[model samples]
Every structure is written in C-alpha cells, then in structure tokens.
Target: MMKMWRVGLDEAGRGPCLGPLVVGLCAVPINDVALLVEAGVKDSKDLSIKKRRELVDWYKQQMDSREWKYVVNICSPQRIDAALSKDGLNILEVDLFAECLNSLSQQLSENVSILADACDVNPQRFTDRIIARIRNWPWQQSEMDSIHKADSIDPVVGMSSIFAKVTRDEMIEEISQQVGFSVGSGYPSDPNTQKILGRLVTSPLPHSELRWSWATIKNKWMEKYETPPPIRNESINVQKTLF
Candidate 1:
C-alpha cells in the first residue's frame, strides 16, 4: 500500500499587535497520526508554557529522526502591513498557507490530506482561497480542508500550533533583547505590551517590530505624536474584521 501523508497548518501571533505572523505546517504518515496524540500533542493554547516548551523540544527530536516533517513561514510586520494595505488578512493568510503547502508538497508523495486552521470566518471560503493559490494540486491526489479551531479538533494542527506559538515567542524574546526591554506577549491586552507601547511611541521613528497598522499602535502614535501614524494606503476594500 502507498504511504499516506497527513498535514496540518496553523498560525500564531495573528491577534498580537506586535511581532510577525508565524504560520506552521506539520506532517506525518497517516498511520502515525496516533503517535502525535499519544505524545500528548494538543492545541498550544491549551498547553501550559512549560508543557508547550517541552513539546517543542520533543517535536524537534522527532523531526530530526525523520518521523515527520514540518515547515514554518514567518511573515514580518512590514510584510503584513503591506498585505493589509492591499488585499487584507484573508489574502495574506491564503498566500502564506499556500506557500507553506507548496514547500511541504515538494517533500511528500501522493495521497496527502491537509487540514488548516481557518483564517477567515467562512471556513470553506478560506479553504477554497488557499487551494486556488497552491501551485501544485491534484498532482498528488491531495485533499484539504480549512476549518475554524482545527488546532483543537486535529492533533496535527495542534502540533503545528505548538511550532508556531513557540517560534513566535522566541521571536518576541529576540525583539525584547534588541529593544533592551521586555515587550511582553505583544498582545494588546498584555500590560507589558501596553507599557512598552507607551515608551516606544515617544520615539521619533516607529519600532521595526511594531505593527503600526494596528489601531492600538495608531492610537498610541496619534496620542503621543499628535499626528496619525504613517500606514500603508489601503486602496482596496476587504473584510473589516481585523482578526
């Protein structure tokens, strides 16, 4: 029998007002799908920080053994801003997810099954958009679905989330190191993030890692600098929803 591949895709830092949007892809042989669940893989959001860190390490070891394969694409704040300025978040995600799929497809054989955590409110629409962007389809008898909360529903997507979450956290730490202070989780509700924003906005130039297009940052910039923060010209209409 031909080996079957099961793939999952998810993203981290989508809601954060800072940091890059990191998309993760994880794949394993269909029969080995149980291995992920047996190894306690679940949505990163449901895992504790220590647990998530531990799983990330374990996953790296497994990938090294060729037990499975994975890929990650980190979309920087600047690129994200540019995307938002044009087509919007949905298009950005579709493009990025397709990019990751293309990379993964290069490594796999036929009969691949892919499940993606939906970036759009309409799951089928999101799936269709991604499929439309993929350069290779039906080339390998592949099937794909994008659904809301796939990370929680599918172990593979949960594993993908673990990768994305850990990677984004490390990136945030690097940004903190560069800034010489902690930027917190980069979420708007994070007090440390809010505090850092206050300090960062006073600077004559915007922070490179900060998402200036975010309303949070724009408001802060306007409040402190007494002028609208420079953002891309949004010439195209898109879904008004931010997340």
Candidate 2:
C-alpha cells in the first residue's frame, strides 16, 4: 500500500486586535494518527498554557527525527492590515492557509490529505476557497477536508492548533518584554490590551505593532478626537452686519 500523509492546518490570533496572526501546519504518517492521540494531543484551547507548551516542546523533539513535519507562517500586523485592506479577512486567511498547505505538501512524496478548521460560516465554502487558492500548487492531487471545528475532533488539526497557539503566545510575550508591560493576550476583551491601545492610539502615529485599521483602534481614536459640531459664528453677528 502507498504511504499516506495527513496534513492539518490551523491558526491563532485571528480575533485579536493586537499581535501577529499565525497559521500552523503539521503532517504525519496516516498510520501514526492513533499514536498522536495516545500522546495526549487535543485542541489547544482545551489545554492549559503549561500543557500546550509541553506539547510544543515534545513535537519539536519528534520533528528532529523526521517523525513529523510542520510549518508556521506569521502574518504581522502590517501584512495583515495590507491584506485586509485589499481583501477581507476570509480571503487573507485562505491565502495563508493555502501557503502553509503548499509548504507542507512539498515534504511528502505520497498521497496526502489536508484538513483545516473552517473559519467561514459555511464549511463547504471555506473548503472550496482554500482549494481554489491551492489549485495551482503542487499538491493539487491531494485530498482536502474542512469542518466547522476540526480542531476539537481531528487530532492532527488539534496538534497544529497547539503549535499555532504556543507560537503566538511566545511572540506576544516577547512583545510585552520589549514594551516593558503586559499586553494581556492581545485581545480586545483584555483590559491590559485595551490599556496599551488607549496609550498608543493617542500618538500622532501609533506604533507599527498596532493594527491601526482595526475597529478597536479606529473607535478609540474617534472617541478621543471626534470633532464637535462647529460653533455657530454668533460672535461675527453675520445677520446684523453685511460689511
């Protein structure tokens, strides 16, 4: 029988107003799927930070022996802004997913199957879009599958999610150290993230780390500097003097 590879794709930081968006992919021999499950792999969200970190380290060790292959694509705030400006988030995500899939597909010489967590409301449409993007890629012959929440059901995708979450968390931590403050998960709901944005948005030109195009930043700017209605020129007495 021909060897088969199962490739999984996932992303992190998609909802955050801050930090880079990371797309992660992992490929393993089809026969080893059960082994990954036995190793305690699950959706990253279902695991604690400590556990995720541990799994990431373990995955690295396995990669050294060619037991599995993985790739991560970091889309910085600037790149994300540019892409969002040109195309919406869905398209941007598809582009990154396609890129990661293409990279992972190159590592295998046999038949392969690609799976990903669908970001769009319609799983089929999301799958179609990803397929379209990778149609010209070398992996055109590969099988594709996408679902609403593949991360929770597919151990391979869960592994990719773990990789993505850990990578983005580390990036955020490094950014926090550079700024000498906690950014708090880089989510709009996080008070620390709001605090940082509140300070940075006041600058005439906010730092590059900020996604200025984001509604969170834009709304804050408006709240701080929205122009009040122009006061009527009562002092000029335009009705009394035509001079």
Candidate 3:
C-alpha cells in the first residue's frame, strides 16, 4: 500500500526572551488532512489573527474526533541555550524534534512518515545532524526527515503553524500584561520590543528575564556600563500602551 499518513510540525517562541519553546507535531490521515486543507486552510501567516484562532478551534475539533493528535514540547530558554551551546542551534533543534517524534512513533508504529519545517532554509550539515540525533530518541520510525519550506509546501505544516502561532501569541499577550507594556513580538527588529529593553537598560533593573545574548541587548549593556559616546537619542523612550 502507498504511504498513507500525514504529520505537521512547528515550533513557537523561538525568538522570545521569555517563556518556553513549544514544539508541536500533529498527525492526520492523508485523506482527512487534504479535506481539512481543501476547506480553505493555509499557513498561519496567510490568515488574520482571528481566522488563525478560528482554525485552531476547528483543528482541535478534528483532533478531538480522534482523527489526529498533537504533542507540544515546552522547553525553557535556559534549556535551549544549554542544548544549543552543546551542539549548535540546528543540531539542537533536530534533537528536540527527534525527542518529540520518537514519542509519537510508539503510537503510529513504523509505517508513518514525519515531516518537519527544516530549521535552516538551506541546510548543509543538518541532514547528518538529524540522522544522528533521532537514533537515540524513541521515535524509531525509519522514515522521518526535514525539508526546507515545509510550512509553505505541506498542508500539515500549515495547520501546525496555526497551533504554534496561536500558542505564542497568547503567551506574548500574557507577558505584556505582566511586564506592563506592549513589548511586541519580542524580536530585535520590533520597535516596541526595543523600547521595553531601553527602559530596562536605563533603569537600575537587573537582566532577570531578558535574553542577555541578543546583539541589541549586548550592545545596550556595553553602552550602559562602558559609558559609550552619547548618541542622538540617549534617553529611553518607552511607549506606554494605554489600555
């Protein structure tokens, strides 16, 4: 018989300074997977936040029917740094994927195929890294692989992306409330995120929750301690989002 199953895998909070990295993999039969996609499913980025949310509920309904199941592996920032330092990010990511898929294998047995959003768009040595990483993990399925642009290509990945993004957005909103500002997406390029960092950098605050290794963070820290030459905008400008 032709191979007849599908899986969608994705990660959330990859760039966040706070919270865990949630890696999720969901599987559906190829037939139903296509049915779900044919119902106007697409990548998370292609839909509005509200639509993505609606899809999450619908996808959850599909899952609740026992037609599929998902696993969300949550790992803290410290854990990610430790693993990345041990063998670099790509390998560590594959290691995480291996762990998750290995668990999924016991349920699906040896017949299913696994597809993942390849961490690097153009992988060089990652293939070897993935091959080696899965060997020790429990997902002993003989055929799991990573492909570039998996999200754009795989309907499974599109669904998985919805779960990942929704989960991350909820966490971001919670964190914003806790921190008392619209810190934005927690990415370096986000101006609101930068503004929040500026406040923390200027105040006598400790680097308690921040990702200290970000280039922007490192540069700001150096400027604070070393007393670098004053720039045009030395003062912190934290844009308060009035609720």
Candidate 4:
C-alpha cells in the first residue's frame, strides 16, 4: 500500500516584542495521527512548558524510526526587522509560512496534505496568499487548509505548535544567558522584558538583538527624547513695512 503524509504548520513568538519568530512544520504518516493523539498531544498553549518539552523530545525520538519529519524556520529579530522594513508584517508572515511549506514539500515523495493555523483575519484569503507563493511548485496541487485556531482543532497542527513553542523557549533561554538575566518570555507585556528594554534604551541607539522597528521600542524613544516640532514664523508684511 502507498503511504500518505499529513503536514501541519504553526508559529510561535509572533506577538512577542522580543525573540525570534519560529515557524514549525511536522509531517507524519496519515495512519499515525491517532497514535500521536493517544500519546497526549494537544495544542501547545494548553500544555505546560515541561509537557511541551517532553512532547518535543518524544517527537525527535520518533523521527528516525517512524519516518516522521520536521522543519523549523527561525526568523531572528534582525531578519524580521529587515523584512518588515520592505514588506508589512502580514506579507512577511505569508512569505515565511509559504517558505516553510515549500521546504517541507521537498522532503516527502508521497501525497501530502497541509493544515496551518491562520494568522490573518480571513482564513481562506490567507490560504490563497500562501498558495500563490508556491503556485509553481509540483506540490501546488496538494491539499491545503488554513483555519483559525487550527492548532487546537487539529492534532497535527497542535504538534507543530508544540515544536515551535519549545524551540523558541530554548532560544530565548540561550539569549538570556548571553545577556546575564532572564528576559521574561520576550513579550512586551512581560514586566521583566519591559525592564530589560528600559535598560537597553538608556545605553544607545540600535541596541544589538533588539527590534528597534517595533512600536514598543520606538514609542519609548519618542516619549523620552522626541523633540517638539519647530514653530513657523509668519511672513513679515514687507510692503507695509516699506510704507
């Protein structure tokens, strides 16, 4: 019997003000979906950090023996800023998401289906945008589904989310060690993250590893030192002065 693959796509750290944006793809045999669910896989957000880590480790163990494959794209703060400079955030995400799917397609020879958690308001439109990116590929005919909260509904996407979240958390920890303190999940709402940003701004412009393009950072700079607009002087009445 021929084998079939199901690919799940998801991202982590999109809303965070710090850390890399990670897009993860997980491809497994169609028959094993039930097995993964039986192993306690669910949405990464619903799982504790320890459980997510454990699941990721278990997935890794299955890669070689079970023919399961996965890929991750880590868009660092610098790369994200560069893309955001040229294209808006939505377009950048579409490009990144498409890249991940296309990359995953290369790893499989069997028929595959893809499901991604939608990042845009319109799920169908978001799926169209991604398809447009890979229209020329051989796998363009592959089934694609983009839906809101797919991670929670689809166990495959849920597994992908877990992979992305775990990978991003590890990356943030490594960065924290380099900076000598906890960065607090790299989200703007995190008080520790904000505290670190406050300290970095006082030092200089273009702080290394920070996304200066983010409104959070820009607003902080503007609030502290943005100069007032120069007042314009009314043109003098030269004729009246001469009279």
Candidates, ranked, lDDT: 1, 2, 4, 3
Residue 170's lDDT within candidate 2 is 92
RMSD of every prediction: 4.9, 12.9, 7.9, 13.2
Instruction: Tell me the deviation in Å of residue 120 in model 4.
Output: 0.7
Residue-level lDDT of model 2, residues 125-195, one tens digit each, is 88888878774544535688889789999999999999889989998999888878888898888988988
Best by lDDT: 1
Cα error, residue 38 of model 2, in Å, equals: 1.4
lDDT of 3 by residue, 1-243 (tens): 644677767776777654456666777776787766775667777889999888878777776565576665655545655554456556657766666665665566444666788786655454456556654433334456677767778878777777777876876787678778777887777777777876656545434345554556667767777644222212212111100
The 10-residue segment with the lowest total lDDT in model 4: 234-243
Q: Mark the 10 consecutive residues where model 3 has the least summed lDDT.
A: 234-243
Stretches of candidate 4 off by over 4 Å are 135-141, 227-243
Lowest-lDDT window of 10 residues in candidate 2? 234-243
TM-score of each: 0.92, 0.87, 0.79, 0.87
User: Per-residue alpha-carbon lDDT of model 4 for 142-227, expressed as tens digits?
Assistant: 68889999999988899989988998899899988988888888888888898887665543464555666687877666666683
TM-score for candidate 3, please give it: 0.79
Query: Which whole-number lDDT from 0 to 100 does residue 163 have in model 1?
Result: 86
Candidate 2 vs candidate 3: the lDDT winner is 2
